[model samples]
Target: MSKSGITVNDLLKFSFISDPQVSPDGNWVVFVKRTIHKQKDYQSSLYVMNIQTRELIPFTQGDNRDTSPRWSPDGKTILFTSNRSGTNQIWKISFHGGEAQQVTFFKNGASQPVWSPDGRSILCTTSLKENQSIEETESDAKASKEQEKEPEPYITTRLKYKANGQGLLEEKFSQLVFIDLETGEKTQLTEGSYHHNNAAFSPDGKRVAFSANRSEDPDFTMISDIYELDLNSKILTKLTNSEGMYTAPNYSHDGKKLSILGHNMEYKGATLTRVWTLDLHSKELICLTGDWDTEVNDVAINDLATGAGSPGAVWTANDDGLYVLASERGNTHLYHIGLDQRITTVAGGKRQIYAFGLDQHRRQAVIGVSDPQIPCDLYHVSLDSRKETRLTEANQHWLLDKQVSLPDEINFTARDGLSLQGWLMKPVDFEEGKKYPLIVEIHGGPHMMYSNSFMHEFQVFAEKGYGVLFMNPRGSHGYGQEFVDAVRGDYGGKDYEDIMDAVDYVVEKFNWVDHERLGVTGGSYGGFMTNWIVGHTHRFKAAATQRSISNWFSFYGVSDIGYFFTEWELKTDKLDEPDKLWKHSPIRYVNEVETPLLIIHGEEDHRCPIEQGEQMYVALKHQHKPVKFVRFPESDHELSRSGKPKLRIDRLNEMAEWFEEYL
Candidate 1:
């Protein structure tokens, strides 16, 4: 594995694995691993394993960040979420282990816990202020810490007032609380100014389900319904009336069904979340993956690991079926479905599972996955012989010595006759009439894809000799929902000829590539398609673009999803289309940019907002073209997936020194 190759210092020697769980009589599993330290930051912890003497252990240690775990329906405890007592709360411990016990002291702390099928209560989620409560935000943080008071002015009237990595706009709101494990008592449970989010609880623990938005202009409607409540008659109930976007929910273990995860914002935010269910005695509902056109979870993006939330579907202990995880085309798998709707798969291939758990008699589960040469771990599958096993090697001895690459899975045809999908790699030291230098990259959820994940910047651009590629062009998401709703109102049209027919079908089918030593990159909507491909094709020769947008008319008022993602991706109506958002602005094709670009961004990006890379570096340096920009500081739009590890290794050495100074 290591004949040298894969460096950004092998991404601080990789160690990822994420969330897994599986422990309610499936004999232990837990999970979350993370790593990266001496390059300063990112630690995470909590482990466990056992699943029949495959023993492992560690369950929470130093460097803070422990995460979501759960279990306890008499599996003898385990709850989780930690910030080691400095903030993010909820603790618990015990499945044959010792000391842990914190469990919520709330002054805006506490998080996702759940456990209540008669385990004497605990539901969680915190954030407060708007009609203030959690004991008046813990007595106004103990009277602003006994009086040094000066910093107070943030009063913005919400229409989504700020939020990228949660900055500014804090009239608070995250809600839901509960607690009581035999008299410790806490109880807030739903307040106002919106946001309730993924709560769960019902296999008869007297109700709790969640997901909120409660209309009356929740920032001009991105809907989000599904309610429930009733923890002894504080009654709430609204189980989705619909304009779309519900969320995680859960229930059905004989409580007669609920299961949620959502969509129906037709294609707003490129829709596809699917898997519905409801039926709690005919309050009806249905969508069980309405014709399953992929994406029921995991949108494969990977810079080593952060994913571990969606444990969505999971039902089958005779709830008549559902295991879920979907994605498709670029593989995410683990399927099942059935109460006669059928589906199937269970476990998958071509890798990238990203997270999973499931026990109390759903046989065996755990998962996490990854591929294109591993960087994610935790496995143990077996739900009736689907096999798997390898429970955690968190980056096996720094990926057994290195030289990685592995990609080649193409498929082309787009000069509008659609059918895309890409991936290429090839260049870590290959020979036989050599040529090389190609790059191409692009992927930032033009509905997210470039699948079979585990990308570390396409393996450090195939260890610098280049040849990368990467596609899924037509608004991605493993295709279908009319190809992820065909790039909403056609951003840079035909997703820029489906990524220039995937770089002209890999330079007319790869003859060791070269094609004038091209290059190109991407970030948010692949940095607005690498600033709409160096302002509409000067055919590559270097370009970068990260966290970009370049003016959907000043990104429809400075982006945090810029006022409804500029009226749902420029279908206009931002007050009757400012000339159709300056005709899909890449700053109106910056005087047709010629190439050597680079831009990058992030100064705390409010989702593609470093003023959309300072309006494409001031419209390509006021048209004298050849750009440069950079930015970063405290970063955002997840500066290349979870920033700061030496600014993600100095943003991959500033995109490998701007493509080694112009391709």
Candidate 2:
């Protein structure tokens, strides 16, 4: 009998492991495991593994969500954030295994726990108002209900007031504070309205380094600077000259140097994230990857590892250099970037490694990895010997009897002689020569790349005898900065041609792909391209646009990041050249659409607000064109990735049904 094929339902059966934390003693690793609960919601828990024997140990199996597991200095305890106590709070569980004890009871909740070097206290982040501190007691649930009954109106006068995930922003800022493990004493370290985040404690524990936009008129320039806070002297010194969006400040083993990551937005939204180093003694900051073209951060886009941690620079065992994530071509690799201006691939392959944690000695590491055939799993790596050991089979149980389609890498030249890369996935059971319907998958970001990561949606399509094509066209990050920025100001010009050329290349090279049965779908930026594609040509038989942008005119003020993003991506200001945005908007040429279209949108999506979907659906319908609108209530732009379990299934079902009906 043939093995079962991957279905949308299998999404609930798969376990997603992320944020691996290596124990200080280098004997074990801990990570968060997320899975669908009762097919209705997601439940995240903690699990530990012994490096020597690879024995899996279940720690927290409760119904509540647990995440961000961090090892204590002595390796006798584990600190994690969970909603087991009704709200997210820090909890500590002993290594011997017993009931976990609540360590923090902050009213605003806490996360990103960092233990002091001496292990006498712990520092964590929590949202706080200008006048508040971490010592504030947890708000009463009953009082919370009372306040909800009379929700306060949002009042803001700042450009950076709103965020996509958090919704209409408040005056609350993320602050770091210390908690005495013995007395539960709380001490606040950051203040003010601007966020003070990405903090790291010094080796001697006398100073704390963090990034914040504590500059004058922070809402305007919006540049964050690195600062060192003296715990005893209560003096704060700015370390960076506010040159870029520098963040994730990590001190060296000797605490004489700091490594940071971020870009100058020098190329606007398409600027590749680069690594930087700072000498604390001389106060000299050096751009480590200034001459390099590689992106110094994980830009892989996938739904498999939701809430996965993106670790910054990990110090080497000798502290002479650092291990950082670098994205090149189409994969996320661990690269060793040294102060001596040398960069080499450490742990790299045709796979996506989302998160990793190094031992206290920086010897071994535990990484979360996944590819087209693998959902998500943890692997242990020996830095000295370059040996990688699979620590867990998180989804192998379900995958063992399932038919997972692996993709074939494709490289083709665009019409402009630009080299483009993508992948082509054949149907689950392929024949020598058989025509199959093709579905072109587009990724969002326009800056983020569709890597060799596992996508459940693509697997579902492949299982249904449909060939899937996903490519990293111009404006995609894995390529160099020039290619990524090529789409700016030329939005629908070359980027659209790059995608169309890929489809043409596949149609000519792979005769199995039925040219007559071409369909296309994408979310966010991909969604925008879908709208533009269908409007521009009648080549695609059908198209599904999710969380798309139909009108850049309205997008200016409506989107959470619209005010600035519109200027950055389109290279046009709403006031100076409003028509330029409209010229590039997909909706401007809606009358040219001839393909049967499906519109999928999340009501709560703030990035490419639901209005974009409504406009596309209504415009096509008004012109008496083929179109259907599918709206997901209480869902956001992340609906397809980390939305409610049932809603995610419903989304896949809708798209599948649409393709089956049209293709």
Candidate 3:
């Protein structure tokens, strides 16, 4: 009884898959299954699948989110985090099947549960206020007293005081915690005003390695160094130099070395992440992908896979090398890195392998993949035979009756002779000789890549009889480091040309595309481009910009990453480059915009801020140009990807109608 194609509300029917954890013996895989709850919110539960039979069984059916499933050493028990008790906490369940038992009762809740090598204790992450002790639990008598106090003014002298999703940064630190499985006793391992993440225990279970910024002025100096802590002596040793951003440290199987995924900030946020190995004994660090141009991580931009855990370096059983995901072109494929620095693709293709869990024996892996046709599904991949077995088809039921719009790859050359690539999805159920309007969709990150991964918005656009054109300009990832870093210091110069050229290529090559009925929309940097595109040219009949930056001068003070990102990307600070900022601002040319523009933004968006949308809307309205503004409350930078379900549907409807009206 469902529709033939994907609809705006059909998003509720799709199930998101993420964070697949393979059992030790490679017989089973437990992963997080996320589904929408009638637009109220999202529900995430853990599901276990037998590798051989491909039979999926419900493991945990928590009302709220239950994630981070890890197998015990002996594979008899599984440790995970759940929020069925109102807050996320550590929980354990036997492999044979039974009701889950709560393990940690931290007052702030605990997550990122990692079992120690001996399986006697578990290490997790928990946040604590400056004065609050880790001994504070839900059962503690002091918890009730502390909860009664009124909120105080936010006092902070630090530069980094806020994040996008999480509002004002509290005076809280995510410290390392250890909960004993046998005694059920919790102990705080690290203490400071800093946060530690990506923790892993040494093979002997005698030491712990984590990434943190323990340097002076942790806010101003954006350096994350790897550190090792001796569980016995309680002595912490700084492993890497405080020069660049480093994270996701993994200890070798033999406990002799550590593999890390990071970059030296050569291009700042646009820098390609490379794999590095640190000799724990010699304290020497080496980048294995130094000569390799491919970025070492999943760069595919996916909006479907919620809570998809990122893959890091997985040590081989023999300790000679490690397996990691590499982003080359538009696809994220698994690659093996040997000690000799040779990188070879193990499982690859056009699909986006977002999350992967290795077996460590070089035998097999469980990967979460999403392509243009598939949302996200688990697959069993053999590292030796290179055979792939489809594990779970979470969206197969409804997808079987839906007509998916498959994207055809497009490779074109920019006016400057720079090579560029993108995809164009024809209108679903198209008929020959019938002209259709084209909608140009731009991606936000300017730093992230938009691959052939399943995009919900793109599907909806194509389903509604509009040809969708999305391409990677110069600043997209999956390309080499130089191509991604090219947009820096040239926001609207060549990057704008690359986008325009893609549009030109599609319109010229396709006979069914109507040049007069063209529309454009994008968010963040893409939003900026949409605003810029309308101002620079009147080719687009309609335009919608979401969470966009209109004025560079005002954005420098309002945005969360405005100051440093301006310096890194724009190559100038507010004080030093006022004229340069004004020159690049789309507001400077707002009077030239003739297209019917719809300005969409999130009220709580600290990243781009709603003010940007307001400025663009006001400028256009003052000039009597066709413009409209719609703001989403209680949403931030992640509005399109993970915003409120109702708001996301509303956003899609707003854009589709806007295009349908003028185009």
* Alpha-carbon TM-score of each model against the true structure: 0.34, 0.98, 0.97
Q: Put down candidate 2 lDDT per residue, 118-222, tens digits, no spaces.
A: 888888999988887565657654366567465567788887777777788778888888888998788888888777888889989999999899887787765
**Cα shift from native, residue 90, model 3 (Å):** 1.4
Residue pairs whose backbone atoms clash in candidate 2: none
The digit string of per-residue lDDT tens for model 3 on 420-522 reads 9899999988889999999999998888888879999999998899999998999998779899999999989999999899999999999999999999999
Better of 1 and 2 by TM-score: 2
* CA lDDT, candidate 1, residue 280: 68
Candidate maximizing TM-score: 2
Candidate 2 ranges beyond 4 A from true positions = none
Report each candidate's C-alpha RMSD, comma-separated, in the order given.
Answer: 22.7, 1.4, 1.8
Clashing pairs in 3: none
CA-lDDT, candidates in order: 0.81, 0.87, 0.88
Model 1 residue 30 CA deviation in Å: 12
Index of the highest-lDDT prediction: 3
Ranking by TM-score: 2, 3, 1
Model 2, global lDDT: 0.87
